[model samples]
Target: MQDEEQDRPLLGRTVGITAERKAAEIGAALPRRGAEVRDGAAMHTVPVPQDGELRTATESVLAAPVDRVVVVTGAGFRGWLEAAEHHGLADRLVEQLTGAELLARGAKARGAIRGAGLVESWTSPAEESAEVLERLLAEDLRGQRIAVQLHGEPMRAFRDALAEAGAEVLPVRVYRWTDPEDLSALDALIDEIIAGRIDALPLTSAPAAANLLGRAERTGRGEQLRGALREGVFLACVGPVTAAPIAAAELPYAMPDRARTGALVRLVADRFARD
Candidate 1:
């Protein structure tokens, strides 16, 4: 019994998960380390490949030659191409993008661009949208037609900043983040967090973190949730981008040196084991 407990570092710990796409994978991983996993997907990714909004955006991009293109996320960039292919504009769209200066926000986006046979002229070292914006702002973007691939939500501020810099910005929203179909699980998870029943909460994306915080605020337990997080519950974020919301709320969190899910899992296990 003593040996088993030593091997299972998280034997007495309960961890909450807020990922929709990778929930099963993460849930399975935590249990292997002896954690009681609580699954509560806070947001859902709704693909808009065939939607009118995406089509219109695609059309606008193809209407004229774009001078620059910003790839924000790998999935979003891939989905945008898939949507273009659905509209029979894949070949032409690819040709047009190939001629433009491509800027990838991170490694994932860079990989997606390379997979599509497109080369990125620049890649952000920090893997942040803010860094992408800063790079664009440094250049004189007067009269430049730029297309920005949005990930899961509209980046109004990002687009607005570009427009302010005298560039015509076109936003391609390949998908949007919506509340999960069932809120019971998420609500229950929130309750558990507020009551300090959960030891740690792991977040995979910015939208999920934002949605969780938004839900708590809507239920008038925002302060309670923040207090609980500050007092007892350990918050683990996958990466800096995913940790933005928590930072905005003035909450402390732990992030792995690498942004991969496996690294995140190890970070959680090691943290608990050390504690």
Candidate 2:
């Protein structure tokens, strides 16, 4: 504790993490290195219902005329299929997935689609909604209907972009994150961000950024959070792919050359001196 305090006087800089897992691996990386991490990781382990609305949704999509399907979240695809399996819909679901042209938002989404014995026709260059829209615009889907699997929060812009390009876009909202039933940790993190008591954030996912912003709004710190991002907090996303959310914040951000955690840490150390 003493070493951390001495090493990171910028302990004043408190950054928060809202990751899928406990962020045990990445949480330890931020301390005393000039960044104080707010271990507000809400593990994205919401049980994929063995059978429920999710299964019904999956069955609905499977039964629909899916000419092309876009897999945005790898975990979402797995959860969706898992839910369907409990209802004895895996074989048919697999069959439904067979003929559609698969579009992957990035490596993670691609992994999920391939795991289902499928593959992507094109993977988003930047693993973001904007990039995905650009890819679709270039594909000439004048009248074809495309299925976009919703990842976390709904991206209205993504669907709108596809529709503008003359493609009938059908979105599948498979899974979404809810704040940890206990909101104290999340609350404190938002407070720190609003106060600009943070130098950098180790952003893990787009939803993390969205969720933080949402929380700030609920607590009446929306402007405060945005200001912190612009004037104080230096966001360091895991990869260029992961930079989308920060960029969407319209806040200045720094990202690593590659989509790797080690690279992100190194990039931070290289650019910012130990304060």
Candidate 3:
């Protein structure tokens, strides 16, 4: 599986991934490694957002004069606005979004928010929720009202920290990462793994890994197959949340000092070359 062509170069190499649009950046990076890209939407095609909660949360934000609004994910950015648009609240959402202190958790998220004509007051240190919250805590949130947008799950610590700092925190759950409704995509992901077609894997989230593993299990070759795939393949994770599922599965994996995609790709490129 060592294609020295892609050893340090990473070209002529293919990493089976399911990240939707983010995959473009990931794919573009591989060419620097001399890698050609292969698509596997089952791997992690980004989830389409369902914004029932976002509507309620945005209304809450408009209701109160909030001090800051933290948006967590790029998907949330598009989804929130789309949700607002659907309900004839696009203009209102934009106005409200701009009114408060706007914080973004990742580069893509920040980019999306800024593209919408709102500047981020605070951009998180890294993609991790805790890191975003840590940066927020450094600010004087005391006696201030803040609204946080949740991607999938509640960030207990982030919310608790705001409360501890004497600030009122409102949670807006904009979207959810759902279990794959279409098993065909799941099946193909398993096939790629079993075939050892994935040279290197970059995991952005635990759910993506779990989804692949689940697909493997359904095919009745989960253990026997993943063992072989794990051999020739390098598994890289962006951060703790992304790495946890691999550790839980007791699989060998690597995580970078920083969770950004740049860091993740660099770690993958450098380590594979070194090994």
Best by lDDT: 1
lDDT by residue (tens digit), candidate 3, 1-275: 55654454665556766564467888788677766566554443332344455677768777868888888887777777887788788897788777787878878789989888888887777667767777778878888888887766456667998999999888877655655556676566566667877688887766677766766777797896579556877889888766766787888888888888888888777865654
Q: What is the lDDT of residue 166 in candidate 2?
A: 85
TM-score of 3: 0.73
Task: List TM-scores for all candidates, in order.
Answer: 0.87, 0.77, 0.73
Better of 1 and 3 by TM-score: 1
Q: Candidate 2: where are CA atoms >4 Å away?
A: 1-14, 31-35, 42-53, 125-129, 194-196, 237-250, 257-263
- The segments of candidate 1 whose C-alpha lies over 4 angstroms from its true place after superposition are 1-7
Candidate of highest TM-score: 1
Clashes of each: 0, 0, 13
lDDT of 2 at 207: 70
lDDT by candidate, in order shown: 0.90, 0.71, 0.73
TM-score of 2: 0.77
